[model samples]
Target: MPQLITAPGEAVVNRYRTSVVTPRVDAQVVKRHVQLGDHVDAGQALVTLSSVAMATAQGALLEADTELRRVKQLGRDVVSEKRFVTAQVAYQQARAQVGAYGMSDRQIDALIRQGDAARADGRFQLLAPQAGTVINDPFVIGQIVAPGYELLRITDESRIWVEARLPVNEAEWIMKDVAAIVTVGDTQLNGKVVQLHHQLDDTTRTRAVHIEVANPDHRLHPGQFVNVVIEGKAQQAQQGIVVPKAAVMRSKDGDWQVFVETAPGRFEAKEVALLRTAGERVMIDGIAPGTTVVARGAFFVQSEIAKGGFEIHNH
Candidate 1:
């Protein structure tokens, strides 16, 4: 059987998100390269920092390197054993400190040979951890930054989620492939129900559901306001002539007749045996085939079909 228009709704894309920047460091936050709305690839630099801490770390690294060389010179020499052990220990300790903060092994090796501080808390650059769209990066040039400060916030826009609230009065019939139009101002997106929430809202007495919509087209933005309309189903089985409830008249004698639209504005009164009525549609037996029964805005049409005026419930 042909399907009636099922559930339909309006929805949009959204994501769980937050902004981040490093805590204030001794280094000057030289600049923020990633800006709001910019798409950043994984490991791409977003902020640069120049700091005394970096310089100090570098210097310590160099000192360790020098000590390592002196220790190596006495390698396998038991007589200079204590001096060799001290130098080796110093180098190993310094190397560990720098490595703890993501320093590369190659950089550490170079510092071992060089007497200069292996690392200097100099200008530093921070890279993006994942590919995402920058959302809240308002850092200006020359802003000082630290390890725990927030530099910027980027949202992974590839996948987005939407939270829709439904009143308990609206039942589970409101779920599934409902046609939904998600709107962000003038922009609109179409999506279907991915899931409905199980928990109920205490204050609003509503349930919140989550929807997933493909945004590979990048039309939908995260955290945008959206409106959803859930169109529910209507069904009356046992196919026969379908008529509007209004046109199926109940007489004082308890009989039913419907106005069959034989012409554009003309109709013929036809007696019908009622099978069932569901929602606004009714199934009636013995109705002529190809009969155009009135369905909508049928109050006036029914009145015209009535040979004599009859009482109808006003309320």
Candidate 2:
């Protein structure tokens, strides 16, 4: 059976799928299009803001558009080459300025359609850059937010990351893309090893292993604790007896041992070393081949021996 390394892990948001919504210009929140925990699609409007800087840029863009149009109608033969070039550059700069203020190209086209300067209200909407659920929305209407101020956070919860810390020695057998099983309470999730940290933790001296798990139903959440069993290559393969896990039990002295039937209806306890486990079966050492040992109902035999006041020790 293949080796399984179990460790405690934590579920965290996949940074690559998370998006932070912020404004490029200082603005006052005008209204919110989506609330916290709402699922939003890419290009969906999230919030509207009003900025004085946006108004100035929009007004300039309108002026530059009019100048460019007039220069085009006049023709290169009529207008000076320098004048035509200046108008074209000014229009492009104006468009870029508004775009930098978080206005989409569609919105800029709409603004141009309005044509009148009075209609340029400096109000624009911030849209979701990707499809995800709104995990956080900290700003309220009428709140003033500066450039790069995080107003909302969106994350695709369909997939997430699990960070598992493994002992340095055991980590050697682990490799990227290995299969892993993550248990959260009664639920089990399948995952794959995505990364392995080279540096060991300062205190634990364990390497960090990152596993990517599919969370289609969003059952796994960030900061949730889980048990991870990673499939790894065996350090060294050796011959051993494979038996049901129930065959082994802890003795009175807390050592792992199995009940061996010495003769007819006679049983004795013998210590054994556990090697590795796969599913319900385990490989163990310290026992000879063809040795008749209890493969099932080991606990019952242990209890029966205790009731008879017999000390469970090796011969």
- Candidate 1, residue 156: lDDT: 72
Highest lDDT against the true fold, candidate: 2
Which digits, one per residue and each the tens of the lDDT, describe model 2 over residues 52-111? 999999999999999999999999999999999999999999999999999999999999
Clashes of each: 36, 0
Candidate 2, poorest ten consecutive residues by summed lDDT: 306-315
**Candidate 1, backbone clash total:** 36
Tens digit of lDDT per residue, candidate 1, span 145-249? 556666777767665666677766554556566555555557656666666778887897777766666667776665566655444433412456776677787
Question: 94, model 2: CA deviation in Å?
Answer: 0.7
Residue 3 accuracy (lDDT) in model 2:
72
* TM values, all candidates: 0.57, 0.88
Local distance difference test, per candidate? 0.62, 0.90
